[model samples]
Target: MTPEELTRPWPPPTPKPAERGAPPTPVPSAVPRRRLLRWAAVGAILVLLVWSVQGTGVSVGALIDGREGGLHLVRGFLHPDLSAAFLADVGSAVLQTVQISLTGLLLAAPLGLAGALLIAGNVGAPGWLRGSARAGAAFLRGVPDLLWALLFVATIGPGPAAGALAIAVHGAGLLAKLGAEQLEAIDPAPVEAVRLTGTGRAATAVLAIIPQARAGLASLLLYQWECNLRTSTVIGFVGAGGIGQELAISLRLFRYDELSTLILAVLAMILLVDQLSRVIRRRMGAAT
Candidate 1:
């Protein structure tokens, strides 16, 4: 109202409480070169992924179109044929499968252990012997299981015996390879101690080294058994005589219900072996 007040210049507006004592806005630093490259790579990957999905025609619509067949399978699973006849057939098949796997496992143990010891140079075997064993194990492992089964079938005819031999030969090589690795990783102190006492190589292994690696060897053996169990069914498809033979026959006849039953039986056997292996491994751990 006064002339002096009107002549005074207007003052700058006061900052709000929230803005008081705040630092000035800062400029963003340049991103690192590596970070930019990473982001670029990630974007490229995403583009490729999207293009692949589209190229493959993988979409919700395709899944929906396939649901009818899936539903039919689910329905058969829900009402699996559990009749006496079915059970009897499944039981016989299961027995044959188990027999083949068991026989193979039994055969693999001695062969695999011998092969492992032969390959692990600590046993004082001749260099030639070790090399020979290594080559033999590699050869067996290199050949596919189906080919082994076919080879045996040609000589022994299409039966459980052929299946057993096939799985045995294949499983032995795997077990030996894994077992030798375990042996190599064992502490050398015990082996050295036995050697200092004038023990023979075989005696030292039996007394000291073998005990240390026993649990691992057992795990390898049980793992091979599990593999052989699964392989037994596959070999049966080639007329080796097991549930897979029945499965092939059922599939050929389009007997969905019977197929479901066979699948359930196989699943049961797998679970049983799984539980058994777990129990055995636990016992081995406790013993060690």
Candidate 2:
């Protein structure tokens, strides 16, 4: 290489683009907004907590202060009266509870399905029919089962029948609302296609909508069964008839041990039903 060639600006010394220090990091899309949102949420929760504490006038700490009493109450479970006669009575009451629950569900299922058909917009029912269905559901749901039980108790007298009727009406309303919602959310393509074939409304619903929502509706029915079971025990106090009446008697007498046994039985039943529901859902899911 010649000295002159070396001295010549070699490929014209490309002036290192005047070092503009470090390149600025671009801000993320919503970092500040997210941070602001996070703080806002935290503040809202703290405010709610404070409001609850002030409004309720019940300090959360006080709940723990009764640890000794709580333990004493819980320990009463140990002395549950297991006499044959007591158990027999309990069994009878339990049967009553089951009878009310199952009977009510039976009555509710069909009524709810009918109401759902009327309520479901996809069913293409007349506007007046839909409105009537909505009104009926609202009426049923708005009135608690206890109130219904009272009405039945007055009209037909107190028994499992009254309880069944009460729960059935309430369950019908709930099922109707839920079923309608489920039908509403279903894909319209199949229904439209069925309609295109000159199918009747009933045929279209059975083929398209009902099939799509059958599984979901069945699950809802099962859940309602569980709810009705629990509720029957409660309505028993109102003389709708069940072990709840026995429970009230026991409570009146302050038979804590008996109460413990009854409570445990109820708890066991609920847990068993819950487990069964989970199993059913799992099996259904697998089958589907």
Best by TM-score: 2
Candidate 1 per-residue lDDT, tens place, 1-288, comes to 999989877795688766797777778766787799999999999999999999999899988999998898778778878899888999999999999999999998899899999898676678999899999999988998889998999998999999999999988888778888888788998889899999988898798878888889889888888888899989888878788888888878867889999998999999999999999999988988
Model 2 lDDT per residue over 1-288, tens place: 888888997577654444655566776789889999999999999999999989987876777997876776667777898989988888888888989999999999999999999999999999998999999998999998889988999999988899999999999999999999988888999999999999999899999999998888888888999999999999888888888877887777877789888887788878988899889988987877
State the weakest 10-residue window (summed lDDT) of model 1. 12-21
TM-score each candidate. Answer: 0.76, 0.77
Could you tell me which 10 consecutive residues in candidate 2 have the lowest summed lDDT? 14-23
Q: CA shift at 95, candidate 2, in angstroms? A: 1.7
- State, as a TM-score between 0 and 1, how close model 1 is to the true structure: 0.76
User: What lDDT does the true structure give each of the candidates?
Assistant: 0.88, 0.89
Query: What's the CA error at residue 219 for candidate 1, in Å?
Result: 2.9
What CA root-mean-square deviation does each model show from the true structure? 10.8, 6.1
Of the candidates shown, which would achieve the greatest lDDT relative to the real structure?
2
